[model samples]
Target: MKTTGTVPRLTARGVATRARIVEAAADLVFERGVAETGLDAVLAASGTSKSQLYHYFADKDDLVLAVIERQTERVLAEQEPQLHELDSIAGLHRWRDALVGLQRHGGCVGGCPIGSLVAELAGSDRPRELLRAGFARWESFLVAGLTTMRDRDELRPDADPRDLATAVMTALQGGLLLTATTRSTRPLELGLDMAIAHVEAHRLSRSVQPRGRREGPVDAGPARPAGTSTASRSG
Candidate 1:
C-alpha cells in the first residue's frame, strides 16, 4: 500500500527506473497487446538500454508481472476516494455513471488492464498467480469501502460487505470482458446498473420522526454529500 513516491533513498533511483519500465510496458501491452509487444519494444519505449532493462526486469515475463502490479496500483489510486464515499445512493450512482463514461470516452478500447492480463495469461501458473494477487488486493479495497458504509448504517446491518465487494469485482471483470469482445458498451452499462440496484436494494433505512405539527414515521436512507465519480473523472 506504499505510495510510489515514498520509497527510501537508498535505492530510490533504481525504484524509479523500475517504475518507468513497468509503466512503459503496461502502456505498450494495453495498446499493442501482449502477443505483439516485445522486450525490445519495451526497452525502446522506456528509453532504457539493454543492461538497464535487464537489471530492472530479468525478462519479458518478469516485466509483464511488474506491469500487472503497476496497473493494479494505478487502478486503485484512481478509484479510492470516490469508492470510499459510496455511503449513499447518489454516490453509488455517480460511481456507476463514471464507469460508463470512461468506456464511452475511451471508445471502449481499454477495458480492465488486469482482466486483459488474465486473458493473455490463461492457463499459465505464474501469470495467473500474479493476477490473483492483484485482484485480491483490489477486492480488499472495495471491501474496506463497503465496511465503511456498513459502519455508517448506510448498508443493512446484516449485509456481508466482503461478499458484496466480491460480487462487484466479478461483475466489473465480466462486464469488461463482454465489452471488449463485442466492441459495445451495453453489457458494461447493464451489468453496472444491476450491481448498483443490488446494492441500493440492500441499503439500510432508518425510521424518521416528525416534529411539531404532527407525528408521523418516515423512512430515511443514507444522506448524500457532494461526491464525484472516479471512473468518469479518470483520463
Candidate 2:
C-alpha cells in the first residue's frame, strides 16, 4: 500500500523473482494470519534474501499489498470462465455452485481468504481500500449478470441489478464468515441458495418452466459497460 513515485520497471527475470516472493507471501499469509507471518517467515518460505525482497518491495506492509493482489487474483481465478459469464440466473447458479465447491475442497478451513484479510486490516486505510477494490471487482460481475437479466426482460422491470448484486455479495460474504466460524459449508450454501432463490421471482416464467428445469446460457442483453469483462474494470 506504500507508494513510491513512478512504478519501477522490471525485466523478465526480475518479474519472475518478485512473483515467486509474492506467491510465498500469499501462501504464508493465507495459512497463518498476516500478523503472524513476518519478513523472516516470508524469506524462509520464499527462499529469498533480505536484499532481494527489499529490491522489489518497500517493506512487509508493501509485500502484503502484493499478497493481497495475488490472493484477489486467486479468488477470481477460482470463479473463472463462469465468473466472466455471470449475466443470467443460470450463470449465477453456476457461480454459486463453484464457490461452494471451493469451500468444500478446502474443508472450509480458511474462511474466505480475502474476507479474513479485510477483517484483520480494516483499520489500515490502504489495505481496506485494496480489499474493498477486490470485492468491488467481484461485485461488478454480479452487477453485469443481473443487469443483463433485467435488460432481457428475464427479470422484473422494477428489479435493481446493482442492489441485487450487492445483496448477493453480502450474502456470500456473511455465509463464508459463518462457514469459517462453524467449519461447515452449509451456512454458505444456504445463504447462496436463498440469494439465488430471491432472483427467482424476477426471472421470466419461460426461463423457469416446470421449476428447476431451466438451464441455459444467459442471453447477452443490451450493451455492456465498456471493459466490465476485463480485470481493469474489476479493480
Candidate 3:
C-alpha cells in the first residue's frame, strides 16, 4: 500500500511462491523480530528472487501484513477447538491445561506469535488495526463460550462475557510475555489460574463446585429440634 503499488493476480505456481515468501517472512519475523528481519532474508529463506517477491507483495509493509495474517490464522487454527469448548468451567481449565502444556513443551521460547508482532508493530496504524482485528477474532470465541455459560445458568447473570473475555485475554498475553522472558510455565499457569478463578467467582452457585475441585461435606449447623420455630426456641 506504499510506494510499491498493489499485488497482481497470480497463477497456481505464483500463489505457491507467494505463500512461501510469506511463511518465510513470518518465521523470520517471529524469531528475529520485525525490525531485524529484512526482505533479503525472506528471499533467501523462501528461495524466491526479488522480482518474484515484489510481484506478489507491494513492499516490506505489505509482506508484514501478510505475515500478521498468516500468524493469526495459524494461532486461531490451533486454538479453535479448545476455544469452542469453553462453555463449561471444566472446559476452561482443560483449555488452560492445553495452553500450559504447549508452553511447557516449547520451553516458552516464543511469547505469542501474534503478540510479538503486536509489540513491535503497534505504533503503526494499519498493522495495529489488523492485529487488533485478529485479537478481536480470538476474543469472540471466548465471548461466545462465556455467553453460552451465562445463558445456561452456569455463570451469574451479571457476568459480562466481553469484559470477562478481555480479562482472560489480558492474563494470557501477560502470562505468555513473562513465560517467554523467564523460560518457565509457572507464570502462564498462574495467569490462567487467576483468570479462571475470576470467572469462577462469578458462578451462579458456589454450592456447586466445578469439576476437579472437591468441597468438604457441608456442615449445615446443628439441626433444629423437631420442627420447633425460632420464636419457641428463643422463649
Give the winner by TM-score.
3
Candidates ranked by TM-score, best first?
A: 3, 2, 1
Q: TM-score, each model?
A: 0.77, 0.84, 0.85
Q: The CA-based lDDT of model 3 is what?
A: 0.79
Candidate 1 Cα errors over 4 Å, as ranges = 1-13, 205-235
Q: Per-prediction count of colliding residue pairs?
A: 0, 1, 0
Error of model 1, residue 68, in angstroms: 0.7
Instruction: Locate the minimum summed-lDDT window of 10 residues in model 2.
Output: 226-235
Residue 16 Cα positional deviation in candidate 2, in Å, after optimal superposition: 1.0
Better of 2 and 3 by lDDT: 3
Q: How many backbone clashes does candidate 3 have?
A: 0
Error of 1 at 105 (Å): 1.9
User: What TM-score quantifies how close candidate 3 is to the native fold?
Assistant: 0.85
Model 2 misplacement above 4 A: 1-7, 204-235
13-114 per-residue lDDT for model 2 (tens digits): 887888889999999899898998888888898888999999998888888888888899999988887887677666776787778777767877888879
What are the per-residue Cα lDDT tens digits for candidate 1 across 1-235?
3333233453878877877888898899987788889878888988887897777655777777677778887777867666665655556566666666667677778788888877788678877887898899877866776787677776788989889978887888888878777767666766766666667666655512122222112232322221234232222
Q: Candidate 1: TM-score?
A: 0.77
